[model samples]
Target: MKLAKRINSSSVFLVSGGARGVTSECVITLAQQYQCKFILLGRSPIIKIEPEYVKNYFDEYGLKKSIMEYQLSQAQKPTPISVQKIFNQISASREIKNTLSRLRQAGGSAEYFNIDVTDYVSLQAKVTHFSAITGIIHGAGNLADKLIEKKTEQDFEIVYAAKVQGLENLLSCVNIAQLQHIVLFSSTSGFYGNIGQTDYAMANEILNKSAHLIQQKYPNCHVVAINWGPWESGMVTPELKKAFTERNIGIIPVEVGTQMLVKELNSSKATPQVLVTSPVFPPATEFNLELKTYRIRRQLILDENPFLQDHIIAGKPVLPATCAMSWIINTCENIYSGYRLFSCKNFKVLKGIIFDETFVDEYILDIQEKAKDNNIQEVEVFARISSEKSQKVRYHFSGEFKFLREIPSAPLYTLPEEQKDTIPPWKDNNFYQNWVGMLFHGVSFQGMNKFITFSQEKFTAECFWQKIEAKQQGQFPVQWFNPYALDVSTHPLGIWLQHFYQKSALPASFERYEQFAPIPCNEDFYVTTEIKSESDFSTVADFVIFNSQGKVSARLFEVTFIRWFT
Candidate 1:
């Protein structure tokens, strides 16, 4: 299993996303240590040119800026920025050549290919021209970090496709029989879940699963999916590095990470998955992995409820779904020892918990096992609220939570786009709260400032966080969006529903719902809704939250709201 003795000149390593970032560094380090041949594949075009052409080309553009200024002063026209940009690209190509030269000088061989991994036809043609691919190191990924509501369809496609589709394209063209090593880079976000990496986490998790499936097909081949933590790489920008440091998470030095990669490849470990992280990122959460499920009880009171007060609808103070989710999740963290809730799927709210002056409600929070394997345990979380006067529980909620089994290796992705239209900013008076009969006292967090557009089946609105007293910020990293902010996101939908029926409506169930990213309370975002179906007493709809830049940041699916059948 030792890498040094096995890797040789005859061994041709095909590294996708090899021309830049950690992938390039790893390849160069391996080449220096193992002296093996490498075929570097990346999206950047390989700059090929004759030596004489380089000399003449730079001689023209490399003249002193002062000289060019003088030349321009004597002429009618000035040099354009476009010309300088071309020079910059040419300079970049030269750098690539220098990197290749260094690889050769270090007693190793390498060739660069400018190709996109997601393009199957191009990848197949490129790999066919080369000798049999001895190994594959896939490290390509994209980041489109938005709260699920703000994420666009494009954001999800580009981010998810890069890791999933890229791998599929590479695997299809490569000869599985000759493939020796398959190392898929994943992240901790994908392992547990991060605040703003829903698409990324989903994509990387697929990589981990794909590795498992591939190993089944080629059992003898080394197929390792390394869930990497934050390392000193291009993806770890200074801002992110500082954020990690603030949280006491340490960054893995490049040399140390590469060494670990070498160790993983050399070690005779049969486990196809590994996690690499230091103490700083998610912080530590205490839990007993030995105990598979957890059960606890809690109480809800109207007088004591400071956050839920503003959610008054139809003269009744009703609990918001986001608040309910946060309460249940926070309790789980407290009991199980602080594990962050990365995602919640198949979330359903069966009934509304309306507060009455005379009564306090008791609730049960139960965590039941759904699935468990090496690094992750998926649990079904249930919450039931019951009144003291009646034995029957009035409301129920359920969802799934994933605890980390492996570190994640996905990169930070951001999808930013223009708003696409020039519309007047939303004004304060335009919020539906002014017209609605409900008094959102504790729930004022849902106040919206602008209505972008509205249709029978679709709606969009803009909302800003209502300033609260300094003491009310709640816990660090805010478990979810401010309940009121999330509440307001559904306001437009409620307004749309009013036209269909005369009775009051409140969210009754949220099925196939997911919180891909967190909605920051301090920022402004858009809320969009699409109605899926309607019945006599209920309506099912999907909602999304969009950041200011028009990218979806969060999403809800199959959300059903019910009215009393009159």
Candidate 2:
């Protein structure tokens, strides 16, 4: 388990609802690990002395009976509600004292405040004095388990006020600039609505959204709303636990739940909201539907796609063939949830988009479902793009998409033995300067770092994986397939054509392409191109892209490039 390096003994943490239950368990873990100072807040007041009758009773049933007997001896009527009230007060005080003692034993100091967090004036007055606080864990929340129709207005207020209004009051008093971390304890009910937790779900969802908004304003602060699933402790009663077990919903252990919070704080990747649920949750099942053709209209302009300016051919911007393939995969993935593109077959560019003249009408992407197998969790779809020109449809590109339930594992790749007669490798700058003159790709697409091996039949090169900004990726941003990396991997083939045939070439079509994993950006990877066949008009080849570990990430089979003669 990785620990957060940023947290130390001197760090001061402010936690709400931290004197008892699951929150107290987490507080103890933090104290044991970091030995930090904590300010714990709760609504229960400390009990210095226990009543004589309740002192001897530990269990709830015994305590209730003892309280009722004491009330009878006092010549008073013992109502059920009055007996339950005294029992609750005794239980809360003992829990709070046990938590405080554990914190001290774990080598941490703590200060407890008995105040309702929903009371803004009192909360603000107490919080304003804490100038040295470094982090905040907003874990205060109440649950009223009643259906919407049966619930009263007071029930909703009690649940919502602790989470929503409490957070507002805390933030209003704290110094935002002095804080380094803000963790909101949201719930899975907020993410996936639950039947009897309407008020709870609404309050938690507000916390999730607030985390995003706060992160945008304070970019340096680590803000995250963890939508945790049901846990083994806290509000889950025995009856509720049995119900969850019958439904096959897994319960997170107290130790595992606290450790996950530490891991989340240590992660370098910043995500504003995340759902942390156990693996026992049910898998997604396919929805039955009738086969239908869906058409999406889109208009491409040179001003919108600035990266196309780098892909100039004959003084005109031309869309790379890789971008067209990305459109097909992204569209299909968006249509269905819990499905990913497994492979694309028979991808052909009949008439590529060239900005020789501005178009006045929108282009249409037509997708039709060909087949679906729910048991296998696979769907086959055919996609095509066309535009109406003078009342006639001019087809641009077409392909077949296969979406599967899971992404396949990356295949192993071994570098082929080099030929003895092959020339020494060319440095990146020297080869790219000559290659770009023929291919006309700009800096954004120029990813070749070094040419390692070259021969008549095969060649290998190391290419830098450049990161594309969201703004520069155009309307069809890189999702499943990165257009820039794919385009750059084909550079060796372009160099081969220029070296032997003295002509530039463009990708015409490919028989099949498979993506096992996403290509990592801002790193270097190896590209190996093997020439299958060559002709005067076109060249057919296979390309394998892999990392330094020799794990094949993607492969293009029987890719045909049409030679250009000008």
Candidate 3:
């Protein structure tokens, strides 16, 4: 609603991460509904998405194919920094032309600019070139694998440099003329450090600082940060993921997230600094084509490891036959908060951190109503440096929460390690040796030396299939799931096998517990949530944590009784 209103029947937009994830959703939404033209800039070449799927979407909804379809993947070419600098200008120019083309087709057109947002010079050029920049929604940045020992002088410099440059670029350019509005996607990862995401956290902080800069430099523009919980993007190394449990860093369902973003952006009546993310941002008019106001839900997993014995129900409790189901859900919510999320290693990166989910909503709302509000065209996430404010404390650990999913066609409970078997772990392809000792578990699981298939995301079926079909593909080697994480959930045991594909170095989706059912099983809990683009169903999960014991303890949920089908 806010977007529909903010974006007139015709507008022009530039989507940084246009080819994948949330950016893809923004592109599709802008194209389909508002008929906004876009300069969908991605490093990759034109993508060959099965347009049939998109066609089906329109047909299903009685919509039109106004969506200008194209494709882009991260264009890979490790050129010198100088050559990259030149490309930034050239790329920006090319993107502008493309964006303008899209706009003209949308009826009353505009321009688009493509630059390596990770590159500063290009960003400045792009910004200065666009005068009617109404709103900016930034969603571009790199997620570095968190490795303390691996941290090098060059890596550190590269990390902060991009962040510094991007902001400088935006600030310098926006000031060239009056700006309208902006949205920055910060992550919970920056709030805390997960096992292998030191760089990621650092980069995320840069996003926050950029928001501050926008407020400071572009005072007239409505600038805000959408501190996201996590989505399947950015950086996460598989081996490093095993030690964390919160998994909130990149666990947002793309569809729901996009909708929330649309709603928040649309509800210009209110402006917020940050929002934890929920269905209801009720301070303004609610124009949802979907149902219900909002809710957050969780399933309590009871552990029998005696390690969780203390979390058991306090008293003898009632007999299994006459137990109240409501009590079970209520108990489960508490248990989930305490044990699973608060202390879960997967999400330790976000522990002990503070953020204002409400702030984001409120801030956006305030900005919408203020006289300073202007039309925003695009937003960007840039690289940044670590601030020296809280340096001394080595934050190896923190706190968290968990939200578990119910298996559809709900079945009986199984043991924690009881998952089906899958392909065993393979040797680390690159000589990095971090995963060297990991084959031990793989040998146990698959009984042989397994061949690797991938390492750092970016491979897709069309890309990898050709590799598999190649005889000389030996030199074009691939690593199987990282010893750290894997998506092989079909195996009785949900193994953490991970290989990069589509998103990043991490397995885009962790195949936890066979399969996951969509949220809202017991409708009384979650109001519901999916769609921005093909990336609509993409997901990452956040666990709300609570502590019940010395270890990461959550209240374990149990089903004491159920109603008869009669």
Candidate 4:
């Protein structure tokens, strides 16, 4: 996870659950950091009431005792239900004013609205006033603690309405296209399940699943559901607090809890549902979950697979690392249930698989779910190639997959300036095929459209889907990390050596490589390569694939290319 871009000052945030709870605390911190406007929502009513003051009338006789008596009498005075309601309203208004004051002092604006989140019509009517809401923090929920058998249907409805219905209503009513951040407050009860929190757990579980679905739909937005543990706040009764203390389950301090929230907001790779809790608690596996795995094999042939044929080195067809990743990813997709692969870490190509007429081989793929902690899962992936005669297996590709609950929002990247004015566009129609020595069929399928700039130290090329009739662009099985597109990204390396080295060269090995994010198939990319070092035997370089949004989809680091000589 990279450092997350901070919230813009122009953006407005909406926080539910009220002006004086955990949600409000998080909003106040965000307000201070970004100095953005906020609209706080709750179901409390507003009423005008002033602080009562006492006027001294008489008596230097027993002055201290008399004043104490007067105060005691005022405090003990009985009031009707109507008067009590007014007092409650006044207290709520004061709390809202205090919250607003704090935000204003920190150079941000804030407003409070009295509306129930479960009431869609009222929420919609109220939300229209804040048309520029760029983020939402939905933290409204109720707690009805009871054993499963003793729990009432009404109890379930009340708890579910706050989180499940509240989230549904917000998602249905809001302008999601404009939203950059969507944070849902979940709980450990929902994630691992507790004894007396059936409704609460169910509601929070809905939040976690909802975040996963929403993230898949909106990959560019930060959709997070934070599953928090118990905190030392108004919600915890004295008996409950004692029980927790006895069990050694530490209650989260308000300051610490808010800080964790801020940390989540600042991380670019935050998982969809982050379980912000202590390590001493019960493990998530207590709920009994099954791990997912995929196993598949494919036969490769040079005549049928033109991609391998095009990527030849020293008169022998060699499989590219990107294609290996494509095979693994595609296999995972065939058995995919709910999880989606987002980022690849520590990716490396160990050996090169050379293909010849006698190179009839089978490629095997396996992706297994390994470790499960909180809301994140670690998947181990492997792709191997072998033949019938020898038991020798070449493990061509290996990487760890971080399955995301919420997709990391697309980043705003700085594009490298194209030096097109100095370098003329390479306008040869069959440039990759004729000049670069790559086969025509392979180049077209890989979506190599045009060259932007090429030089010794730096190179930039453009890749787009071909508009030609009957030409299929990006036809590879693995569309998420488009190995064809990745191959296109490395086209400059091939062209640079072909133009300057006086000999055709193929990439034999890569020293190291990593992918920050998955490459999207639809967008046209500007592949930028920089020469880090060069010698007669080998050339090492780094390259980045920037999408149409000028954001890097994949970055290859310290790629050591051993020259292919025949």
Candidate 5:
């Protein structure tokens, strides 16, 4: 197969076992993330999404508004009548007119191919026509009682042949011009072997091991395996699904699983593999497991409202001032926006605040291109205004609310910190869109970071910023490196020594501390000074942060194992 000399927009991709469950999610994900031609491989070219299936998903997500937006009509479902309507439309002479019109308006490009992975000849022939493929996501599976029930003799043969044969066939195609990645779907059963699924277990074992084999053979191509655990899908019966995951949440909510899978796939780690999620989860940050050199006194974002000001100021400086809370917050906002729009199936966002080992380089690479294209030095996004004196930007579409880009009609108001006068977007409603602007105090940290003069300046914002960015010339901020993996309680002083230039902090700024108000406890404060276990942080530790004036700043926090109720 031939891929373009370089994999870019002209590349092609395949997702076998798409149109169902996690596989479909992969297809949707790659389609949006990469501009490439897509071929969806499934058992049948005709995706007969049944009404009952649609209804089942709607029932699962029982919110009325969600139901209205996501669920399809009975007519749209792949029922006999629905199928007949689709067929008629395809060949409509008014009789088959509907399908013709539908075909004309399918929006994006998609072609379906029916091929059984077990049928080796058919699989090879299917991919041969394409010169090369940039990527292949093998999410298809015969997860029938995957590990739940004993397998028949046939089950062993069928499961193994499908994944092994299909994968080997693709790899055997030596002439493939360029294949950057080959992602295999290995269930969690592979690692935590399943009792009942002897045959399916073998198939997963093959998938589980295939990544290593591919890496060995083709160093240029990244062979990634995703070990997915229990997920909500047709493969999972309701009772079994519940047993497989934590209570109160649906089986590994499809979106979370999908998001986790994509992140794992994009990672360049050696033989990169990721266990998508866990069955049980902890609620808060517990960072007593660290280098113990420091402790947080307090930490909080500057606020326009005085009450709000004191709200977050109860922790240590878990995040350095050099840390980009704005960037982190904006990343979450972008994630939220994508999920809200188009109900993009695979575009999943985790429900609550939890920081796991996330692969951020992939995300940066994807967004970096956009930033470069837009020449976006720094973008000041005004999300919410909590005060009247804060910057409130408005576009010229107030009269026509719900206008293009869904930009708001009125500026959100908030108090301006740094004490600048809040500028009104526009005093006149009839003003031009360009004329109506919001006050956003933004500075680009992308560059202009090399010269840091710390020899003699007061503790002004500029001085603080220069000290913060002393080491940030070629490198991104420490916060941007991997916020998820950060052990918060370790950085006790917020005194970044690498970036910490001359002692400008009143001669002995590091020499003193006095406890303000000690809350009488069961004498049960689980405290830690530093982290020694870098290897263990990923499996545990929600996050760890040093506090400022003892204010909380990180989602990853500091509580020992005992403080947790469970």
Candidate 6:
């Protein structure tokens, strides 16, 4: 989908905390690029005149000394706190003036208002006067860094209200239809929890989730929450920089960070939540521990996962077999800190999960480490899941996962020869509608775009990998293996069975599946299924998925399915 143009000379932006710090740097960059109008909101009042005593002293040391000396001349005690307050006020005023001056030099007009975003009445009144606001950037936030045990109620309020409440007030006052873009500046601390930023993390997570909800409500507006790491400028002090260096965490440069913001604003992609951090921040896992078994339990309900409604079979919702494999792979990958799934061996669906009269509510997944080779950075894990209703331990699904430090390259695939003249060509929509009472999948599960070729022994089809949102994925979001795309890849085999034997089938097991890389959404790829063996009650086939360039993305070997007599 195409997005509207972001900004122009006539576009007016309402920016919170835009007078100074990182937000100020972004405003300056935007002015230089687009020459747009900006309305800056801050807590610092615009001071046109400087005091005579501190006017001549521009340096910090000189200014502090001058303020102390002037206080003594007035017969008042110059405490350290009082002197520091005056010094801060002077510095803030200068920063604001410098920002306005730089914007003017860059061919942009700006106006600053001394309004505390936390106060809804004051923020609403100020926002009402401006009716041309086409965009909003929520960059206002406060830091009260303290350990959770030592944190106070006031500290939480100060830090939380600045981000959560500030955005709420802005959204409450602005005209929702007029806005073209909305950007929320979040922190990586929220994405990955931090030690002393409990309150800050909680506040920023709200922003991240809010972006998703807002984008769903207003499809016309581009809303995004960027979870940013520490930058070279802004809140990173020299002492903190030293700490980050010691931990091998890289800091983002000011120029690079601002440019990323500009790119996000102009991009057409509709990802509402993004995490931008240094690659080194999440350190690699060191596997030197003993083998262990981990058990995790989850409650599964059909109502909670709305996508299952689309996967109805015989008027009953049933979990797709590919989704079961996804759970196994995702569970294994998340066990280690930095490991990724290389392949799955011997994946079996012992019993299908159908939401019939007797529905299973809870399931337990057990992952046991079977083998590890530290020299090659590879580990083998066995995973299985069982339901609570069964008296005996009956596993519904099971698989063996092989994880490696990095994914290996996939071999090139040779396209199979097609007998196009033998079988009549079927349109995309017609195939889905007239397929022999076998295809019961709804829109979300139907990914087969068109049939390239079809025969009794083998077939090739083009599948459209549409993007599935988090809410549609049922239990979890799309991680390593996209269940929808992988599920659709098996449609060719199903069609072959229905056309020849006049029967329906469901996937029962697979000998192996090797994944070279993740399949991207909003793209088209080809899946070719070739029959290996066939019997009265079962069929075995091999599936290969490749791009237009003939590079294989994934391969499934010895895929066996149980045929049902119709």
TM-score of each: 0.48, 0.77, 0.37, 0.46, 0.41, 0.75
Query: Ranking under lDDT, best-scoring first?
Result: 6, 2, 4, 1, 5, 3
For residues 1-566, write the lDDT of model 2, one tens digit per residue: 22223777898888999999888998898888889999999999989999898888898889899999999999989998998888889999999999999999999989999989888888888988989988888899998988899999999999999999988888887898778788888988788776688999999999999999988887777888999888888888676676566546789899999898877876776678988875332234465757778899988877878889888888888888888878878887777755778788899998988887645458889999998878788888999988887787888899998888767889998765545357544443556576664657887788877666787788887788688777787776977678889898998777778777788778889999888877656888889999999988889999999987888879999999887763
Candidate 1 per-residue lDDT over residues 25-46, each given as its tens digit: 7777787788888887776664
Top-lDDT candidate index: 6
Candidate 3: where are CA atoms >4 Å away? 1-5, 9-15, 37-114, 216-220, 232-250, 269-272, 275-566
Superposed model 6: Cα runs more than 4 Å off: 1-11, 32-34, 41-102, 112-135, 142-158, 165-182, 192-196, 209-224, 228-288, 373-377, 388-393, 409-424, 427-429, 451-459, 499-503, 549-551
TM-score of 2: 0.77
* Number of the candidate with higher lDDT, 2 or 5: 2
The lDDT values for all models are 0.67, 0.83, 0.34, 0.68, 0.38, 0.84
Off by over 4 Å in 1: 1-5, 48-92, 280-566
Model 3 TM-score on a 0 to 1 scale: 0.37
Worst 10 residues of 3 by lDDT: 361-370
Ranking by TM-score: 2, 6, 1, 4, 5, 3
Q: lDDT at 108 for candidate 6? A: 95
Which candidate's TM-score is highest? 2
State the lDDT of candidate 4 residue by residue for 1-566, as single tens digits: 22224686887878888587677777778877888988888887544444343124223334334444555676854334544454455556666777778888878888888888999999899887677888889989998888889989999999999999999888777888778889999987787676678899999999999998877777777889998888877366666566465444678998889889888888878578898766333322221246666556667655566555556665786777777766666665444423345655566666656776545457666666665444453333433433343666556567665543334665555655666674645567465556645322354345655666767888777777433222222224544556766766666676677677754444544544445455655567777788999889878788877787777777776676666552
* Minimal lDDT window, size 10, model 2: 278-287
Q: Give a tens-digit lDDT track for model 6, residues 1-566.
A: 43755688888889999999999999899999999999999998867899999889989999999999999999999999999999989999999999999999999999999999988999899899999999999999998887899999999999999999999998998997889889899988788866678999999999999999988888888899999888877776666566566446688888998999888888888678988876433334678669989999888877678889878887789888888878777777777755778888899998887888656667888999998876787889998887766575657898898988767887787665555685665453555678845677777777777667777777888788788677878685677788888888887676777778888888899999998877656888889888999998999999989877777888999999887547
- The parts of candidate 4 lying over 4 Å away from their true place are 1-5, 51-90, 280-566
Worst 10 residues of 1 by lDDT: 405-414
